[model samples]
Target: MREDIEFRTEDGVTLRGWHYAPDGATGPTPLVVMAHGFSAVKEHLLDDFAGFFCDGGLGVLVYDNRNLGASDGTPRGEIDPWQQVRDYRTAITWAQTQPWADPERIGIWGSSYSGAHVLVVAALDRRVKAVVSQVPLVSGLANARRLIRSDLFAATRQLFDADRAARYAGAAPQMMQVAWEKDPAEPAALPTQDTHDFFFGPIQDRAPNWRNEVTLRSVEMFVEYEPGAYIADIAPTPLLMVVACQDHLTVADLSLEYFEKARQPKELVALPCGHFEAYVGEAFAESAPRQLAWFRKYL
Candidate 1:
């Protein structure tokens, strides 16, 4: 059965998570610590992945990052990358104490921006047994370049908002728009075509609180933050890199470069779709099972 668990972060914010324990399992099973991508709630994107693992005789702990969803924190729309990484660490540490989790066999899974956080967390926490980073955004600079090429004005405005939020620590300026807005000029602007369906369609059914707007301040730090730099140190431990050959949200070529630098015990699987399409379209069925197999082998 699955239960909702609430826990406190080091910064005094309350975080809500879903814990799925396999039926009739007597002891700790392998656990997957799953964190959501930018501007997304944990339950919407992660629950399916968690459910699959739980059904396979594993425990899955999926948590909402501090400022979004049901988590307690100020500045509702803020997206501080470093703070998110710290919160992920705290969540992983907390997962170790859950009775159904095997601390030594815990693995990390993330996609897009939070996918980068999985790498950051794994490097700092040696206890992370394995990691799966799917179509990760290894560099903030690359993301910035993509946004600029797609929409200069909207990208600039996003940067301004994020900086203002960081300086004030109050509620960040709100950006509201429909999910399927076309072009970057629209308020809830998206860079690619699949993003509209991926970000809005699924959440429309499951989570009412989902929004496409993220704190603009995230732009300031996201470009400079490179999670791929530490990939070599995580070697000998299992690391799975899922690359989308035609990704538009993140740089696919840069991801390939990082994969080249990474050491042994690493495997890269290339898919034919763009970034978000793989998560919702037919590829998800193909991708999720492949990832589960890799985690089962390593964890």
Candidate 2:
């Protein structure tokens, strides 16, 4: 069972989410609020992940971040870490109102930035019972260094563009097409890969409805937002960190350090691929069952 819907946040911004319940659920069940990664819409990650969890007898709620897809917000892509955390917290509160959900048995699932956000939110809110951090961005400093190593001048240039847009137009202008050049030495900075296509690539070929173009400001925000800093704060609650071994976007070493600092009842599952590959390749198929099993056991 699936239903498209919207819920208002603490600041009056409406968040769009899809509620997917088990097919034959006759009683209340644990809720899984699946948060999408940075600059991504709910339909992208939740479409597949939600189906898996719902099939496993758990209800799922997946939503777009404010100012992104169907959600309401201004100055698109002005992603503040605090604001994103609040949005996820608000979604959890909204989920409690549903009659089919067990209010005290709520879980949060995230990947990339949202995966990191889950740790931050769990630290602040005591209501969350379980968490899944998939390909989590563990450190800002590490990512910043990685970006500079790959394209220092290109990263500086994008920052300049974002600053200019924010000052003159109240929001950074969207990039319909990334500044990617075919030549290697030409300094084109996107995807961080020569052949890595953007989110519009074939992963969504089976489902082409996902549309997202982020304001360049997200580049700056991501560099400053480090959820790894607060990893030790997430205690008692069961945590699962799914690491992408060859990930360039989020370093595996940094994530491992954070996982080590986390309290007991924590588990790390390292996949044999990069950041986006798990969402597209055989890794995702292998990883989904483990995540569902963990959430079912904890929440």
Candidate 3:
């Protein structure tokens, strides 16, 4: 069964979430809090994950981050990693209040950009008993250095500065395409065919609420954010880091570096596929079960 729910953040912003109870559930069950990645909504393949978890006898709470999807906030399309991390904390607090939720067994799950957010959230929020991060963005600076050419870095910085000025001058937030069809003349935040097809192809069709554009300031915040720094802190709490071996977006090597620094009670599973491919097909088939097992053992 599924129910639409709303919760208010400490800042008074009303965030929305979907609560899913396991089929034939008799009483309170462990809840897994989930959210989508960069500029994504709950409908963007998140239901598949939630369904799998719920089917595995775990309750699921999938929500949109502030300023995106069904959530109410200003300056839409803004992607602030820190703010999103805070939203995860708020989601946990809200989940604990649910009548069918086992607060002590609450776990967090995230993919892509949000995968990184869960690491930070688990580190600071001891209440989160377990965490599963798939294809996570560990270091924003490292990823920025890899994705943004050195020649274009300066130009990108200028755009960020310009957007800040424009926003302060009573202008609307500057918007940019999150991903675009491969074109040398038209650069996008994620200007690759894989990113383009994944976001604009069938996924976009399935998720009617997804916006293909994000604020310029979102890119700026993404470049400066670093979630890997908190990985080691997620020690006493169990963590599962799933990596796509052929991932160019988040890159497996950087993720491994942070994973090595992490303490015990952690597990790493490397999938034999690219970042986006891990979302479906044989890769996802291999990953989902492992996640369920980990959550079962820990949460």
Candidate 4:
């Protein structure tokens, strides 16, 4: 039901992933193009999500974002939101041309960081027929402000400045853990308890390729991103946003605020759990089915 595939982006970087088809299917099928979030690989609960669609008689294109798991890119563990957004469009273009895929029926599913990317893509690329952004990072700057301590804000800015100067002088890019297991107060990229537990937990046994590190510059770029601003532009394309009610990383109030900014043809479903919980256990059951229904209705 799944096949390994690779395609080049416009800039010639190869992104790799799986193309899933329902068993005994024939003719062109609606395809949902998907990618993982910040510093995440497809093994991070994406296979489970893809199965929900593929099992419901839809095709799915699940890929590792560039520089993470199963995909190829340089300066590993770096994440540039705009670059990933471009790649999402690139993946959609490739999926559209596939013999088994219906070009006009392309839908997109993204979670966490890539979740925000899909919002930007759907607004800019009219070819996206439908979109599902789950537990998305809406406002990077606000999120950073919420997560970082005010007293440490100056020191944090210093980190970004020092990293910039070091790179300017030919030093290797500075790196930081994607999550910190022992202390939430640490200087890791995510710096939240749920993020640490989610990334550092047993899921690692399933996805060993996932490194705990990210480029320090990735944090700077993250704070500058404001994908929520694109929400208002996503109308005319059916959109579904899944928000975790108790989410600390991407707070619920902020997500709700942006959801209102969006015009019609959009729906918001609240999962009564924290951000990371939406990926597994009961929350996954709550989140995945509704998303599949959206794809079924609009894809």
Query: Please, what is the whole-model Cα lDDT of each candidate in the order they appear?
Result: 0.78, 0.78, 0.90, 0.91
Q: lDDT winner between 2 and 4, please give it.
A: 4
Task: Give the clash total for candidate 4.
Answer: 0
Best-fitting candidate, scored by lDDT? 4
Tens-place lDDT digits, model 4, residues 71-164: 8887899899999999999998988888999999999999989889999999999999999999899999999999888998889999999999
TM-score of model 2 (CA atoms): 0.88
Cα RMSD to native, each candidate? 2.9, 3.0, 1.2, 1.0
lDDT of 1 by residue, 167-217 (tens): 688654644432346564554434555667676564667876665566545
Q: What is the overall TM-score of model 4 with all chains considered together?
A: 0.98
The regions of model 1 sitting more than 4 angstroms off are 150-184, 187-190
Model 4, position 173, has a per-residue lDDT of 91
What is the full ranking by lDDT, best candidate first? 4, 3, 2, 1
- lDDT tens digits by residue: candidate 2, 1-299: 99997999887899887889899888779999977776667656568889989999999998888877777887665556678999888888888998878999999999988899999988778899999999888786677687566646565656657677676876535443222335444432244661235454665464353444455556656667889877888888889899988877777888887899999889889999888777765988989999999999998
Report the CA-based lDDT of candidate 2 relative to the real structure: 0.78
Residues 1-299, model 3: lDDT tens digits: 88999999999999997999999988889999999999888988888889898999999999998888899897888888999999999989988987889989999999989999999999999999999999999999899888888998999999999888998999999998888755635667776667887887777778777777888888999999999999999989999999998988888899888999888899999999888898888987899999999999998
Backbone clashes for every candidate come to: 5, 0, 0, 0
For TM-score, candidate 3 versus 4, the one ahead is: 4
lDDT computed for candidate 3: 0.90
